[model samples]
Target: MNLLLIAALIITSIAVLAYIGSMVLQSWLYSVPADKMPLRSFVTALLAGGFLTLWCWIDTKNPGRYDTLFSFSSYDTEDFDVVDAVKKVGEEEKTIRYTRRSVGTKMVYMNDQNQPFRKADAEGAIFALIVTEKDKPVRFITKLDKNGNFPPGEIQYREEGGKRYIDDTMIGRVNRPGTLKVIYVLLLNFGHFLIWTLSLWLVMNYALGHAISIACCLWLVITLLIMPVLFTKTRKQEKVITPQVSFPSVNDPNLSEPEPKDEEKKGTRQFQDSNGNGIAILWIGSAISNS
Candidate 1:
């Protein structure tokens, strides 16, 4: 079962990667103009978004199947209660108690010395056969689930005295590594972010055709309006047009104003003869006379 599950996961991962790779290749080959690229990229991102959504859904549906292992913790304690009972055989007597804790599909029990003994379910009902180690090193007889859950049914074990035994499995075990759990959580969050951003892009693309172009224009205008306010140093410095006034110095030998040129005289005469306002001519005459 573990092999089959691992194979399925490997196949799924490969298929997803292959599909994403094909889309990326297509995107590179069919590169479009900036105006149209957002939609294309959005489409590619949508595929990833869908995959993420499905992945999250699967993880949620199966509870601890993908992200973690299933065990007694998987079930709510409120649903089941543990009871203690004593049993006496024809020649001996022993006390047994059902445990609330479980490791994978096996039930955990405490011996008279408080040593833990695990029992695997043989079939549909619980069995008396138990596995325990009192004076030897712990040995695992069954593999843990990828998420760290225990397998169901019977487990084969060998005693310290070289005696072999088969016991019924009772509870599931979960042995998922911390690193894998962290990676899965991070991937889930990243996928959600990607999906959200790309989904917005897709909606904008369809609802507002040429959304990219419009966004660019808005961005340009906003930058132009905001830059000067944000960075006062970047504000355009206005040129100061200072009027030059010349005054004759008291110590100067030549104090006479320069005479008007022929073009200025002609412009003044023309301005006077045209029956128009002579304000322009007066200004020109004054400037020429001053020069």
Candidate 2:
């Protein structure tokens, strides 16, 4: 019903669509085998999830909620400059100039042509933006999050001249301390980069714990040592089970042959039984015995 809500829903739907499309493409492009299904499916799902998250971000103007795209990109100079670089309408020959000014002991403002840039052509201009602080700059700056949200600050931008003086503000946000927190806040909305760092750290910590945990580490070491013993035992059993027909006697019952008296004597006095064609027998008897 609401415009913003509708926009959000649309964006979410598009994201889902993109994700499914990517999966279909992946399957069709590569003839993945069944054994590798889990790995391939995981990759496809992750990509789809990322797209869906990006869709939500575009719609909601918030990328923090989705882990998929949380670390996708980062807050670069472009993101920082978008709001600060406000251009004056109908000033092609004259380049718009802006200089930061301290309005009072606790208030500071940017002056455009030696005046506070308040009466912007809200309708005719592409955008009008101003930064406002709830507290003094020194105190507010300390409290500002890297994501560019001050404790309570306002960005007054005119999308169209005479539209409205309504300001965009982020209110009651807690101050994030230190450079790390500030950087995190700024990149908080950057879907991929922020998430990657967080995920990597979490995974590393988990892996380290597994490697260092007393019980688990001991179990791993024991298992590694035991594996070679088990393997050797298995090989020995296999060798023993395999039939060994070493030095089999010529007269053995398992050896098939015609009548012994009918056998022919070779030049070396060895008897040859023609009927013992397929028998794997070893003749250990002396040639003179039959003679």
Candidate 3:
């Protein structure tokens, strides 16, 4: 089904989107001066988060890289661990060892000699890994062995059964039943975006998309709706100019001199408001005729 190719495409798409989103978020935080966190702290935190996201993307696109890092080698059924119960009374302790065939958290890299090559284990559980050589699949198996030590590794099962060379038979280590490690490995292999189990729990109680939408709506409400309050709480009022008339004293000698008889009969107008607000309203008739 070319599942690996599909997985790669999905991982790449999400990674690019997340990277862009984080950049945008960082920019938005910078622009809001009132709600802004320290620039250095915000940048450092965001960079760390982005780096983790990038690693997750790489791991998804190339699952083999993580397998080589953590998934232990696959083993056969003959190596499955077994223990005899010593129960001589009622209510004995749980006995049978639980085993499941899946991908290993550790991966093996061969250095051209088909020998186990050294690689660091990713500090997390890994489920399935697709192994290939020259773009061809390899066969691997995960089964118990006679020694009671369940080790996962590449398998040569049914290689001589008229089958073409394939490496798709590798199996991962068996995890203990009802253990966090087991659950962690299983969830990691789900190949979906990893988040808190509590979120998944909420999704169980409520629909995933609905829960996600609610979260987004809450975020918007906080960011957009509360911005005014934030600004009001953090801001100081600035003084702004309100225009009013200012009169300048006239010192012309003509103002002090007596007028001629004909002009004396014409009365001069005084600009004033009966309300006594000290705002002068110009007597414009004289000014217009003069202009």
Candidate 4:
């Protein structure tokens, strides 16, 4: 199989396994309801798959952009004088020395005259290295120690038998440069992964809601399950309590109770006509009784 394909397969397999393990752990630790397990697994797989797909697409479109974004240059010990090395920004040059600046934070470049350059000029050189002169491998002269020994942060090349090889540690430094560079690469990839995962989840959630199937519902349940499981406590499942409703029979005493009538006025009786219109009639007691 092609190396890139093999790498992709390995990465995807690891992602799937990691996702499954996380879900299993969460379910076991938090006692995630059985009904929600399938959905959670599906969502995890979807997110992992989507991120991997996006990464693969980007990698396919531009082969080495991802690697170059985080890569640094390596140098041999004899090409330039370490003590006299200077960082050139515009027309001004500042001497390079060990200082408090974080490692890999400084962008270093060599001009056609074999000089160190930085800032805008260095950036232009980097662009050319990544684009125009990509066919050529870029390397640099390493800085030496006080005892003329190969020092940290410098990758040295050596010749053995009729072949040239780099020391193991030196190869690592060449590939990774510094702690900060590794961290930067990690954070960049993580940011991309998060963005793609969330976007895919949202679109899938919306589409699944409309479709409405056992799988879709399970996915929704798992989606709901994540927030509460990761960030908050799992809510106690409440038992469905059916309210007991009782109706009074016609023979019950409560039902037989007559409603109280309004007290009659001393000299007026309220009457309703045949048309159901109510009117107040002025009358004496005997006349009211007769009416």
Candidate 5:
């Protein structure tokens, strides 16, 4: 990736991982509105937000961190799951999908970086991972559905030559623009700030010994660069599908406000402006990083 893009990622990550996440946590957990919250609340929420993110991160067991001094804290990883190592040895510059055909493992191990073969810990199926050197458009998979429930999947078990085998596949779930599921995910995206903050600390520690690397991770600088764009975009997308809601004065009764557009009323679609909270930058960053 180019320095410009990397710079963008560091900036985007910090904004969501701190400012925005802090604001939400303080408002919900502390019952303090964002405008009235203090600086320390932001920092404290930043720490608290990452508690879940850190738990999730550690759940991955960091299989690739094995070579470092933190190896003892890391767990064994497969070649397909390794991240830091590069796959420049082969002539194939094209993208690839890797898999294993072992007794209990299906397709696994895209030979990039140290990504390891995924074994069927229980029952498994055509475990899919599509990777490419060429950058192309992709989509986001919301792990949670609209009601914050796990999406459906198919996992079948069988016995092959006395060896237990498992098979699985993801049932498709799309959170398109204006969908409640999309909004839910957009809301959950703030939790990612904690993970980013934790990552920032680890990265800063390493870059502290290297001056040039330090320049790449100035979060405050990048946030300044991005804030204006966010401001303009937010204002533009604040429009409502229904007529503008006019809450009556406390003296007036509040009832079913108004009917939405036909599309929204049909239950087929709803209107939600970009619903951006200045966090889509992280989406771009993650997509870029994966590429």
Candidate 6:
């Protein structure tokens, strides 16, 4: 099997989808037309995310865009010292040095390169990462400060693999990155629509009438009125998008294509309108005499 080709296709598909999704999200956030967003988004993701995707493919096992946005904190705080007993090659335990910074309540540890060692908490205990241990993952001791407590914050307790085991030791307690990303996408894209529609409905119904049915009726009308502007696509964009895994098939006779020239010749299609239209209505038993 051609794994490299497969990986490329997968990554390209994801990058395009991610770009479109993020574009729609931006539209909702910025009150821009969603259709007009894809062209620009498609260009940027293919050009920018393409290189990052390649780098990740070369350096890592999985395929994904290494977006710096979700990867880092706003800024690092002043560094503090942390001590760890890492196992040596033979049978000795050596002190591994690290610098820690507190991003909010979470303590981040960085190596000599000043880069974060643990991208995520669960990744803490990989054998490639570990004490008097041979061919085993390194073990870590609970850290304490001058006050003799575990730094008076969350432990982020590590286990066999680089995973965070919290008070609810079960894996169910931890939310996966993919799940979190989905949630964030939904909330950002549709959150404004929901907030405004509900708020307007609530206020109008309360002031005018006092019933669930009345509020629901108001909500329906408000939805239709507001949808023509914010949180909806207003017009189509005509810009050509940059490359992102598109292979046009020239030999396909069954493919359906839009005939813009024909549509344009008709202008705004009017009903009444034409014999074809009246016949279609008559066929469907909805035709009535003008008189």
Q: Which 10 successive residues of model 5 have the least lDDT summed? A: 80-89
Cα RMSD to native, each candidate?
Answer: 32.2, 31.8, 32.9, 26.3, 31.1, 28.7
lDDT of 4 by residue, 44-114 (tens): 45554454444444444433333222232222221211222233344564443311122376433444454
Model 2: weakest 10-residue lDDT segment is 74-83
Order the candidate numbers by lDDT, best to worst: 1, 6, 4, 5, 2, 3
Candidate 6: tens digits of C-alpha lDDT, residues 40-100? 4444344433432333343243212121222322221221144232423334434444455
What is the lDDT for 212 in model 4? 34
User: Backbone clashes per model, in order?
Assistant: 24, 23, 40, 2, 20, 10
Instruction: Give the higher-lDDT candidate: 3 or 5.
Output: 5
TM-score of each model, in listed order? 0.25, 0.19, 0.17, 0.25, 0.17, 0.19
TM-score of 1: 0.25
lDDT of 5: 0.35
Question: Which ten-residue region of model 6 has the weakest summed lDDT?
Answer: 167-176
lDDT of 1 by residue, 121-162 (tens): 222212222223354332224343543335665454322343
Q: Taking the tens digit of each residue's C-alpha lDDT, what string does model 3 give over 83-187?
A: 111111223322211223233764433333343321112221111222343555333222335442334665332322223322322222222223443454344
Estimate candidate 3's alpha-carbon lDDT, on a 0 to 1 scale.
Answer: 0.34
Task: Judging by lDDT against the true structure, name the best candidate.
Answer: 1
lDDT (Cα atoms) of all candidates against the true structure: 0.41, 0.35, 0.34, 0.38, 0.35, 0.39
TM for candidate 3 is 0.17
- Evaluate residue 96 in candidate 6 and report its C-alpha lDDT on the 0 to 100 scale: 44
Could you tell me the TM-score of candidate 5?
Answer: 0.17
Query: On residues 1-291, what C-alpha lDDT tens digit does candidate 5 reach at each position?
Result: 232343344344544555555456446644664453344334434443333333223323422221111112212211222111112123322233444323354543333443553323222222222322136322122233444333467433222222222232311211122344334333333334433444434432222322223223432343345433332322223445787787668755455467678877655432232335336777889899999
